[model samples]
Target: MSVFRYTLLASVVLPAALSTVPALAQQAPFPADAGESDGADTIIVTGRVQRLYRAEQTTVGKAAEDPMNIPQSVQVINSELFTDQGARDATDIYRNISGVSFFSYAGVTFRGFRQDQSFYDGQRGNPFIGFSVPQLFNIERVEVLKGPAGLFFGPGSPGGIINYVSKTPSDTSSLRMVATGGNYDRVGISAEATGPVDADGIITYRVGGFYEAMDPYRRNTTNKAKIADGAIAIRTNEGGKLTLQATIYDNYLRANRLRGVLVDDAGNFLTDIRWNANEPTDFLHLKSQAYQARYETSVGDRVTFDAGVRYFDAREAQKYHEPRGLDPANPDLVRREFRDQIRPVHGLSFMTNATARVDLLGMEHKFQAGADWYDEKNVLDSRILRTGVTSLSLSNPVYGGAAEGDAARAALLPFTTTDTRTKRQGVYLQDQISLTRSLLLVGGVRYDHFEDKVTTSTGGAVSNRSSYRDGDVTLRTGLIFKPLPDISTYVSWSQSFEPQAAASQDANAGGPFAPVTGNQVEGGVKTQLFEGRLQANLAAYRIVRRNILQVDPSLPPVNGVDQLAPIGEVTSKGFEVDLAADITPDWVLLVNYGYNDTRITGTVAGQAITNAVGDRFANAPRHKVGFWTRYQFPVLDAAFAFGGEHVSSRISLSGQSVQPYTIFDASITKGLGFAELLLRVDNIFDKVYAASGFSAQSGHFPGEPRTFLAELRVRF
Candidate 1:
């Protein structure tokens, strides 16, 4: 069988083994008699945990107990919610969280943080994006922690951090399978299972995998993907455990698009788009593999040690087509281009967490402490292409590519292509100190050091360019106060720093510049309501980034001479709100909103003058909003939901601006014995706007329009 078919068949068969667990696994137990708020009531997760109606004892035990104790603004997106929404990609799942937004660019932003600092499962995933690769199917939950995690993880932003929780061993045993298809002829299938392997019930394991593919919701675009993932865990009565997890994913996309520039009647920069939907075509291909092995053991009643090693490799290649005009007369022309990028990232992290209930001189307190280490390597090979010969320039607007495609496409010299490599490593530690029953203090710190190397290739020969080295210390501190059993409020301050790669843009560095450094300071409050059935959190932060990276306009393009690098600084500030609740049994609500005010705060010499449509960072918007909810039908045994995302207009990396647009989406599901069925709709309005462009204006690829998908999921 073809890989796609084989994937679907595996998904279908896995669930057959789990159905024996009984009908209870087929339908969630919380929907029945959900209204008795005070009776064996369900707790509301407030975007913190999966929107499940489970008590503290039912959820991950150690996890559920600390939400009210931490001072930082954090959130947990549960696994059940993943099933409830049938989320297909990381963007589909995380874009709904507050303080986070996936803008018009293919870039992601959290609060005011740039795309430079993203990680997966607390380990580095996409070194290029601010967030790591999308969470996979076996994810148990998603954790979003705000403020500098410098103390426990590495040098992370005070804005927040994201960790994809993998599904591990569980006492509950069951099997699951899923099949789906939708607009763009999109198709996906997958399955999973958990149970004891021995009659003694001393050992258990969970395993699953998935396959998916889809076409562009747009008329001339197509998006297809294939995925396979699984996990196995062995458990014993001593609380000792060892597990293995793996995934293989491949994605392909093609588009006949607009190149990266847009001009008005007089040919002045108006937007970041190149308005040519009909062209020679552009495409991107990506292949990724991630595997991890984890081991956990209990040392005593108060101490537990967890250690894991994860390895991930991703290779991506692209041919970007740039179409630079909007006047029907002058056809779009291809411009700036990127060739190859490969990231081989791996990390070995060992954490010793000791939690103990201690009588400290007459007062009872809970104590937790740990240490961490991380290493990352990044490699990028990029090329810039610009035709030496000028097109009609609209002087004679009535010229076609047929008239120009020959000479214009011919004069297009590969100009300059450069290869870059980055290496970073760090170590950290954290501690939670209790002062009183109602007042507890939290603090942690981390130190990091990084090394970067830049190499350029011309005619196939590689040459060394320059290198960079830098280090910094990050910190986090907070306070929590619980005046009542059902309520807890806290305030926190956090910080994070990016490498100095952009620093090369400093006037002192001359031509090629170094990486920039970014940092943030934030304070926020979190509260739980109605005995923790409902939750809400709000935070405000200021981010001061130095030597903001931007192309050096002064550095003219030369075949083997110089490269453009970030040459300025910009400071940004923002506020965020996150909420989740179970207003009543059978009804669940989730929402996240972010507001940002980012602008060029400082500029180097000649920067302000030459940059007419330049300087403002791309992929960032001033406002973002999203909401989703599911309401169950006790009698019909089903539920339906609708949710969508809205983003304000954004600026081009080159400083041009794109108009603002909003998208709406929704879905529905049904329950059956040992199975559940679902139907999902995306972009119901079929808006023909840009959902994502290439790094703030390379091409105008239409966002997916209205589409539909149906899924059959079974539980054993």
Candidate 2:
């Protein structure tokens, strides 16, 4: 079906279903006069508890299930935890998660693998496209599901998936306003309000927006963003609910897409940490619009159904001076090249699922079945201009001397213009069976079909056209044993697959490359201690990935073009511990630690320059530790929070070594009845470290320096 028809069907079916609510109410699936709360209840609670940082249930698996019983490594970071830390973007909350670290903008290294795709409300799509970071103003919580999730989320990186849960309209009427100011001339204001629109309380609405601008710590750089979000919910008398949501985002960055500070071969800094190579006119801009519709209902006392549709459109344009390397003849100067890129993307997705509870042969079972479809088109128009005379000095830098204006653009060389389309569809089934009171078995399987088509042109003439189509089946199974009501142990196995991009294929190969596949085995234990006020999870896992595409060194080049082959394999083994506890009524703490070891176990015999046996994966740290604790003083209505993170040294993709670093942060909060004030400081020690790096020549990204922020929030 066409995207328009699918959207039209959803728009028509929702109101039609609501019209039948009166007739369905006659059946009375739920007791009308019981005076007991049903599943759907909107109640806002004030104050804090031990569970404030811990989420008991999650929808990441396409159903509402307890994380302790899922037999996998799952973690959640709620708004309360990040809000207290003065978080401005998604990366600020990564320290609370285990086995996760920064890779680049809006990207992370997950369990020794790199992934950028994120799910919104359990649907597959990303609104924050290339180089754009996700803002946290409209998010309710962030959930991370570790290991392969192909059985539920479809083809993706084998590492795992990140899900963003949005704040929806509530029946409870409330208004919240916040004003914030920070170092580097940063300032922002936002307001959010939700309430019922009708006297009967059947219709509800939520609206929020924020605008912020700042000068970053880096020299000659600036950042600005504007966002608006709105949502509406309608409830039927029979307990069915329909919701519609819309969001718009505009972001601008000037001289902010920095490659990093230059470094020497021995990993020593060659320049100041805040040094930048981009010109004042260099900028990156992105604009996006997204819309979604969701409907949920219960078929009977033992069954529930959910369906959702989402459409997104985004455009990103960037112009920057990319640092190449040190000049061959003059080591004191760095060579540079100019790049211009324009990318536009459109995406549509649909998802539906149903869960049923049944009993067979004296054993209880929970079964779920779902199907999903996603379509996206991405277009890229890029150009580059290179000149030997464009260089920057190491000791003294000068700007406005490089190429600019229409004349420079007209002299630029066309790199490539390509239009790519991807379509994916999947169906999955899962069952959770209880054989006895202490033992449970869970199993699931999924079938997915993926298609990719790319068209490339140069000077308005078609240069190359490539198409790929393939299908695969992924499986998952787990067994859980409960020794006590508060303790559980489980083991699981899962598989995943991801198709290679068209651009990665060699034009001389004349055949589509095989998709990469991965599988993992894991075991874990979960416990609740201290009268259920503390939750702890420990897990160990090993993953193997095969069929990696690489250049074929054995075969001679076909007309000076390299040949491609799939003869690479990698293995990653790791363990993690996550803990959340409330030592006392006024004290809450969160701690996590991770140990990962990733290496290339197999590769082509002749390929020694890039992939080699026993080589460590890039950006995969072997050890990581994080901790945060907050203490509240009831007498003064105030709180104090302290947290920090430490990451072990890592290797860059180019075999360059990066040093380890530790950072500390603290915050203070004062409650004033209807208002609250917060003061936070990051990098308290002003430590200098490299967050990540591609190579010593291109530069290494530097960690933020000491910074301070103050915020005032009023609620009514």
Candidate 3:
């Protein structure tokens, strides 16, 4: 279906469904459940009266399991923490997670590797694609799963995965409205409501939407977004439940796809941080609609089954100017080029799983078996047109020189059109066995078959076509030993696989390459100190990636053409520490630190090409530290929060050095009966630093300067 049609249908259907539900009186707050269990009769009670910075369980493993029970490094940041901190998008919460940093728009440098894909409710497929950032209006929590997760998620980076758990329908009835205003002409409003559809509480519904508009810190840049989300749940007499959810997003960004400011060879900015190379008319736009349905039921007393299906359709387009290089005649002038691109993506995901609890021999086991399938088709059309005014001064600024309107587009030539399709299917089985009261074993194995095809055409004529099909088996095994009830020490080993391009630029020289594979060994200790008031986790790991494709340095060029080979290897070793403490009834603190070392380990031996064997990975910082603390004053009915992050120096992909920097933020919240007000200030010191860099020509992305935001929330 078209984006407009789907949006219109959802707009009509959601309100009609909600209108049928009768409103009820507000209910008192209750203990929040972490999530659904894996058919096991284990109940983990956190005993939290109010929202805390710590999370006890996660569903990233296809079930709700305590973080201590899982051997891998896992962390969760809930809605309360991000909301209190005044987070604007998903990237704003990265500081709470160890070993993570921004790579670009929606991507992150995770454990020395780049990761861009995200999961929703433990399912694969992300609606927010390309350069778009995901809004947090409908998110309940963000879960970070470190290391390889190939046992469940097929074809992914070896570093980790991020899961966005959405807010679902609840039995409690409530209405909330929020108004926000901030510096830079920022304004936003949102409303959310949830309640039961009938007096018997057999059906429930939730609907929410938000509209935001802002002019960013960058010159000639503006952002606006509108999002709508709705969900409905129906419970059967037999305890079976079905949930349906829909989301619509419309986003527009003007001159927001900037390549940052011009920089010299020494990484010094030659222009102001807010400098813009593109015209005010340049924009990036995205429109998306996603729908999902899930059904869960129990059989007998030990068996449970759940199934879900998700469909996502999105269109993303951008018109931007890119810096090519400095003019040879005049070093003070930079050459620019303009391009327009249109991308459309369609994705479908279906998953079903069953969990059974049984006692075999003298051991108790929780067994889970599942199968999942995903399919996606993405198409991109690109057009490039160069105007007479393609150079801009570095010291002085000028705008509105680029060509505009249909006349310019009509004269443009088609650069490239690429159509790519991907299909993946995997079946997995896992078992959590208890050998003794003090020892536990968790093991899983998955077999995945992946197929990818790419077709490239220029000027409506096919240029190159390539297809790849592969199947592999990945494994996960972890052993946990508990010496005390509150302390656990564990070791784990996991494997992952990712598909690579099947062909090289010279199709005849290098026809195909093998898929990349990675394995990691990790050991960690988890402790619940002071009667579960404090949670601490420490982990050390080493990951090795093989079958990496690189330019063949050992082989001479055939027909004056370079070929590619899969004979490269890389390694990443790191240690991380995360701590969360509810120091007192009115105070909470969170701290995380990460140290990583990533280097190329193996490559072809004749001559160096691209990078040396011992070179470190670009954009991977060696040290990172983050902390946040909040204290409430009961007498004043107010709370104050402070947070900061520090990142060490790093190298960019083009061999340029990146400077280290630190930034701080603060916020204050006051309670006023049924309403609450919050004031937040970010980058209080107005530190000038680069978040990341692309190249000397493109320069580095500048961090946001000092900003202020105020929000008021009312509930009824």
Q: Which stretches of candidate 1 lie above 4 Å from their native place?
A: 1-65, 104-106, 125-135, 156-158, 218-221, 254-283, 319-377, 381-421, 502-521, 547-570, 604-617, 692-701
Please state the error at residue 266 of candidate 1 in Å: 14
The digit string of per-residue lDDT tens for model 2 on 667-697 reads 7677766577777778877888888766756
- Model 3 weakest 10-residue run by lDDT: 36-45
Indicate the worst ten consecutive residues by lDDT in candidate 2.
28-37
**Candidate 2, 95: how far from true, in Å?**
0.8
lDDT of 3: 0.81
lDDT of 1: 0.56
RMSD of 1: 8.5
Q: Could you tell me the lDDT of residue 697 within candidate 2?
A: 69
Q: Give residue 317's error in model 2 in angstroms.
A: 0.9
What does the lDDT read for residue 3 in candidate 1? Answer: 50
